[model samples]
Target: MDGIEDGAQPKKKKGMVMTIAAIAIVSVVGAGGGWFLGGMLAPEPLSSDEARVLEEAKATIKAREAAEAAHEAAPAGGEHGDAKKDDKDGLPKASTEANGVLQLDPITTNLSYPTENWIRLELALLFQGKPDVAMAEQIHDDVAAYLRTVSLQQIEGPRGFQYLRDDIQERVDLRSEGRVTNVIFRTFVVQ
Candidate 1:
């Protein structure tokens, strides 16, 4: 029994030494492989020429941004380079000619039939000569009142809408006394 116990102790010591040796060899191999891969994947340093080019690119971007900012700050006008093109109100000048057709504010009113349904309309008046803002307003009011009397059935289809336009134009002619040439319908929406 004594001999058998001594033999078992030496066997355990030998197994432990073998495990330690195996672990050390594997660690050394792993470290060498990692070092080799890292060297191969390392980036090359940038040259002086490449660094100068990068600086130039950044400067160009900054210059372009400054130019765009200046352009946006400038007032709107007739032409891009014309400094005197901007109007007194700083708003973009209208492209319309003298005594040209003038657009008025939109008119909203409920239809006579289907009183719940509301209609919106935008109008432009073609003047025979100089546009009178006062007369234009009066015509706009008359048109709004006239639209209120129109039933949904009266302005249902294209034909009905044509009738409405003609009626409105005729009314404008009578009110303007040959001053207004035509009544142009810009937009119409029903809700």
Candidate 2:
């Protein structure tokens, strides 16, 4: 019986070694296959045209940065310097009136529900004929007032944004009495 048990122990050890060897071989093959597939499926190098466009974009960005730096370094006392100074955010100020379009001053107000959250909107109204400054001011005030009543949830998604746009358009039409043909949303930000 003792001899039989000792012989059985060697067979058990051999079986365990075979199982480990099989696992190792499978793991190595799997890793090699994965590496080969990854190389095969890798994205191709950018074409010459794509590379040129990328370089051009980089150059344009660098030029813009240098121009901005130069502008910043220059004295602020030119004809447009007052306008630049007036712009608190350093961006180019939109003209209030140009042709039949009249841009309203940016409207910033807190949300009704969450008072901490605020909305900033810049809108341009396109008039059918001559732009009415009085009507435009009234519309701007109305829009600002309307926005104050809005909640974060009211303008959360694309559909909500569309609804807000529609509401503003309708309000502008009512306030302008059909004088305002379109309301171009220049900027809309909520924070």
Candidate 3:
């Protein structure tokens, strides 16, 4: 009976040790696999072109901030006194015309079916070469007219909005006679 008891105790100890060792091995393997997967799924570093563009954008923003600060610190009078005074909103406006882009004034109109519901849209026209302010104004008028004919249901959901965009693009293309390359919708609000 003594020999049987001793043998049983040794077998139990060995089984316990084996179970502990198995658990430790599994934990280590699990941790390593998780680490490997994390590394594999990590986002790659930005490419050279993307990094360059980001840096350039940052520099441009910094320069703009410096210019704005300098402008605020200096007296209102300058060589372009009228130009400075004409900026009634005190907002620095980008020279869109220089980049062949013409932003039209906001168009506010009522929907055809529901006359009470109104829509305000702001758009920018990109020209193939030099931007024609005259043509842009014409397109703006055309868009306003087209909006007046559109019902609220025609511009409700995402699909409707896409169709609206396509319709506006087609109208602008026809009106500009292929000179206008793109119609960028900046803002669209309904009330």
Candidate 4:
């Protein structure tokens, strides 16, 4: 009876080993099959014709970008150029209109310490038409007066300077209507 029991134990262990081996084989085969199917179902590679079309599309996009850049770099001249050129040539001038620019000197308005001071900036004014020159001069004078009135604390930082520039532009524009199109700063000194 004892010998029979031992023999039955060995048979049970062999059966368990065979079951584990079978499970491992099945898992490996399933993993391989899944990988093969995924590869087969993936997107196909680009054909020759598709490749050519994509290349042509990229070229077209590049050409359009280059053309836009060139257009921006070189703006087309309109009626303004012909008149200015004719005026330069000393032809029969119909109008006494001429382009003019005005530059203002930098003035120290506020002193904060031994070295720091709030500087008042004046921009060079330019115009194509012969508008009121006296009014333009008055605008600069008023800006200088306004800056002189402001405290050192008010015009100490970059924000204050930017505000002054914008304010000056707005005031000048309001005084000159649309005749004065541009205001350029010829000199800016802050010390």
Candidate 5:
């Protein structure tokens, strides 16, 4: 009986030791699994300020894209060709006496006073049909010569220039035998 009891004691001790080893193995596996999961699920760390700035940058980019799309989709007449075409067609076409506007290059003249300055004067003639090319060249030459004769003092002020323009129109009308009715200035430069 004594021998049996001692043997049973040894068996009980071995069972307890096995149970402890199993529990330890389970704890180690659980810890390793938790570490792996943490690595997979963890988010990148960012300061609050940095996060706010990133959000604002994203918003700004989206807003600019939206604005650009809107601008492209809508018609902007001021910057487009349709507006210019409309302006040209909207003007009342000149009558049989004056069919359309004739654009002419300005005659540039050098002034000999105070400073070495230059003046440019443009002219637009209203006439019926396309005038003969030779006649137009002759008219241009005659007008340029006439402009060369004008004194600097006579065309110094706005009123003086206006009168000069009117006088030039009248002279052109006379030269063309009433065929040219009006003159419009396309560009004027005094520098």
Candidate 6:
């Protein structure tokens, strides 16, 4: 009786192990097929406008970085015997508008609900015609104000973030009165 029980145990264990191996093999094959099909289906052609926009966004970021570096290097004292510095105004000297694209300075703010958490965002705008610096500034201020009111959880997950972007875009559209065409979110980080 003991020998028969031990023999049956081995058969049961062998069957279970074989079933697991079969399931793993099936899963791997199914995943491989899905990956191949997804790649084949994902081939997309870029339009001329998209290409131009990507180039413009790159240029805007470079210009912004250059301006920030220049701003930092110059001495603060205007009354010095040295030649008076340019851009006495607070705004950075970077070219904010170029090739129908407008880049605004980065915005950093603390969330209202969770005062500890902070958000930093960088943005670029694509205008209908030429970029409007004044309206862009207005939009920046509006975004800062809106961000101050947002709770940390409001922009927690992917869906929450999508909603946040849509809300901001809608606000910009209304404030710009359609002069501003599209809002390009360059960077978003919450810490």
For each candidate, give its TM-score against the true structure. 0.51, 0.52, 0.54, 0.39, 0.44, 0.52
The residue-by-residue lDDT of candidate 5 on 44-107, one tens digit each, is: 5668997787688668757966875786577756654443332222443333215556556447
Global fold similarity of model 5 (TM-score): 0.44
Location of the lowest summed lDDT over 10 successive residues in candidate 5: 88-97
Give a tens-digit lDDT track for model 1, residues 120-154: 89898988777888998999999999999998888
lDDT against the true structure, per candidate, is 0.80, 0.83, 0.83, 0.64, 0.68, 0.82
Give candidate 1 misplaced runs (Cα > 4 Å). Answer: 1-94, 97-99
**lDDT by residue (tens digit), candidate 3, 1-191:** 99999999999999999999999999999999999999997756779997887688668757966876787677666565445342323433345555677778778788996675678898989988889878988999999999999998899999999999999999999999999999998889876
- What C-alpha lDDT, on a 0 to 100 scale, does residue 114 get in candidate 4? 23
Candidate 2: 10-residue stretch with minimal lDDT: 84-93
- Pairs of colliding residues, candidate 3: none
Most TM-score-accurate candidate: 3
- Candidate 1 C-alpha RMSD relative to the actual structure: 23.8
**Per-residue lDDT over 145-191 for candidate 2, one digit per residue giving the tens place of the 0 to 100 score:** 99989998999999999999999999998998899989999899886
Clash pairs, candidate 5, are none
Worst 10 residues of 3 by lDDT: 84-93
Ranking by TM-score: 3, 6, 2, 1, 5, 4
Clashing pairs in 1: none
Q: Give candidate 4 regions above 4 Å deviation.
A: 1-97, 105-108, 111-120, 152-158
C-alpha root-mean-square deviation, candidate 5: 29.4
